[model samples]
Target: MTEQKTPPPPQIWPTLRAADARALIRFLVTAFGFEETVTYGDGDRVDHCQLSWPPGGGLMLGSVRDETDDAWALQPGTFGAYVVTDEPDKLAERARAAGAVIVKEPFDTDYGSRDFAARDPEGNLWAFGTYRGEPR
Candidate 1:
């Protein structure tokens, strides 16, 4: 009997809508250490942007809608995402120094993880921790 090939696991890429995408991109790189991979559109209107986390994974974002364009846009802080990192304290410190809003200081979780939460310039909540979910 031939063995069946298993399908690939689902990828989770967090997407956010920023009021000022141009500025938000800069903030994300400086504060959270996300490197810009690709950006679409121009000027103040950002159609899509892909950023690479320092460790792994990716984040996508776009600019807020204009007065007449009513597609789908999330208000800042309306969504939250967790990121796995090696140093939560250090990461939090870096973010704080870069002017990110530190919502929760780094702390040891009962689940055996050190984590911290912060709000981006556009008020997007982000959590960085030592906990990397199990891979399928």
Candidate 2:
């Protein structure tokens, strides 16, 4: 397989903080087809959770400790996730219905993609697009 980004530690972990981490995980799994790989927490309070996709890649989720630890903190329009999908429009719609804030409307790009962007609840931006490059 072609190497990309040093290959994750068997996973491409992106941190996510939500009011309901479980719900978010459920939504990701059920709606987006992610599988719960490893979850670490207590009493429904998740300190850290891992979710993996079938083909490859995984996302990391955790609880926000509202003290001095700002790692889990999210600011308005601050986070971003670039996801390549066969149907950008559909994914954007799903994201919108799932309460994601649509940042940029779908449009064609000179870089070779028809894409759109959305911001998740924790301020992370998710981008959907088909970036087809010229054959090497």
Candidate 3:
């Protein structure tokens, strides 16, 4: 049998703030298939959380707090990100079935990539596509 290697942890982490962090996390997992790695906080307030995309990379999020209470004051519903996926159509279907709002239907791009866009419950725009970026 061949050996398998685990990919290294993501170096850059996209971050966001949510009015209802717990609910946002649930929606992300149920709709987009993000893996909830860890969460910290008390009650409904999420101080910090990490959700990992299966393909690679991940994102961090926390509950929205008053600007005076926290130094990083990211407003809810103001985050956007593009994620690479091999099956945008299938993912879009899953996301739709999970009550995600499909902002853009699955379509082919002129640059040779399948893509789709959706909005989570908190109104974060997420774009899923097959373009893995240009070669480094």
Weakest lDDT window of 10 consecutive positions for candidate 3: 1-10
Q: Report the Cα lDDT for candidate 1.
A: 0.85
Residues 1-136, model 2: lDDT tens digits: 6645442433356666666677777766654456899988887677889888555666788665574667557533344676657787887777677776788988999887999987665566677687633333
Instruction: Kindly list the per-residue Cα lDDT of model 3 for residues 60-121, writing each as its tens digit.
Output: 99999999988999999999999989999999999999999999999999999999999999
Candidate 1 per-residue C-alpha lDDT over 44-64 given as tens digits, one digit per residue, 9 for 90 to 100 = 888999999866678898887
Per-prediction TM-score, please?
0.86, 0.67, 0.91
The lDDT for every candidate, in the order shown, is: 0.85, 0.69, 0.93
Runs off by more than 4 Å, candidate 3? 1-10
After superposition, candidate 2 runs with Cα above 4 Å error? 1-11, 30-33, 66-78, 132-136
Query: Clashing residue pairs, candidate 3?
Result: none
**Clashing residue pairs, candidate 2?**
79-125, 80-125, 81-125
- Candidate 1 Cα deviation (angstroms), residue 135: 5.0
* lDDT, model 3: 0.93
